[model samples]
Target: MTATGTGTTSTLHADAVRTLTDWRPADQDQEQLRLDYLAHLAEQPEGVYRSCLPAHLTASAAVIDPAAGRVLLTLHPKVGMWLQMGGHCEPGDADLASAALREAVEESGIPDLTLLRENGAPVPAKLDRHQVRCTGKDRPENTHLDVQYIALAPAGAQALISEESLDLRWFDFDRLPELTDHSVRDLVARARRLTA
Candidate 1:
């Protein structure tokens, strides 16, 4: 993957492009496209074709207060949406989990946090796949592979809004704001079901 000041980009071979274009949206089509794209890259001759695909790594904390039935959320500026705390995965990070932990700490002032996974493990999963239009000038066709995880934070923690966010607060599930992104709402629903 190659990323410039504008955005990241990735190139696919003719066959890969054809496959991606021919794919029909289905429950498994998303995963199939990802696999095909990865395989296409694996078969490419090194240095011949440079990819500008951006690796988007995000970590979301399910700051749940079971008694209060509330979860922490942030209002993002770019999308003007209220969602979990996460951002792009940076280089030399321990892993995606570490990136999530770092973002949660930076966005919210909760110093003490615990990441919860099935069986109390830290294993990562392919939460979902998305095709986002590039906002950068270099490559306008760039898309993101968003990796999501569930984390836990202490109750009544004060949030420290960074420049990336407009506001932050703990919201009840039933009282969630009018979200601009359907994917984010899906994540919230999934998290609620899992936590409940």
Candidate 2:
């Protein structure tokens, strides 16, 4: 599980490689993306870290209020888009699931959000690879190979906006804002099926 070049090791990076290697993709497209992620990890020891040039692995969660048939989204300041809650894996993160959950809770400010589980552990509901300007306004774009999950918000849960977001709001599953892209919608659809 040690990355070849870095000499230094990261448990998060090792966990990511193991998790993706063990995951069973639902379709051919997912299968292809899974392989691509493994390849990235194989070549770059820092692939799970944001500092990895060009591309890196990110963990995210779609916060779903299943009782209300709503999904909580953040108005990302950088992209100016309504998107899921997540970010780069941190050093403290024990695994991809923990990273995704930490991002979800921190971004949403909803303390009790719980990840939907599979086999008694939080598993990714979907995977998305997208271009982003994560470093700064002046920096070139990077690719985020996002491992997406679903989190269930407690009844009457209220979200506070973090500095990372311009705003935070919950929208009906059928009425997500126009600012969102197909990736968000697709993630929501997969979350919906998981919750159902």
lDDT (0-100) at residue 152 of candidate 1? 67
* Tens-digit lDDT track of model 1 for 57-147: 2334545554466767888775567877776644434345666677777777677866656655553333445554445545455445444
Cα lDDT tens digits, model 2, 1-196, are 4433244557788888898998897999999999999999988878898888999999999999998889999998888899999998876787899989999999999999999988887888879999888998899988999999899999779999989899999999989999999999999988888787
Clash-forming residue pairs, model 1: 2-51, 2-52, 8-52, 9-52, 9-53, 10-52
Model 2 regions lying over 4 Å from their true place: 1-7
Indicate the worst ten consecutive residues by lDDT in candidate 1.
3-12
The number of clashing residue pairs in model 2 is 0
lDDT, model 1, position 52: 37
- Provide the TM-score for each candidate, comma-separated: 0.66, 0.94
User: What TM-score quantifies how close candidate 2 is to the native fold?
Assistant: 0.94
Total clashes in model 1, counting residue pairs 3 or more apart in sequence or in different chains: 6
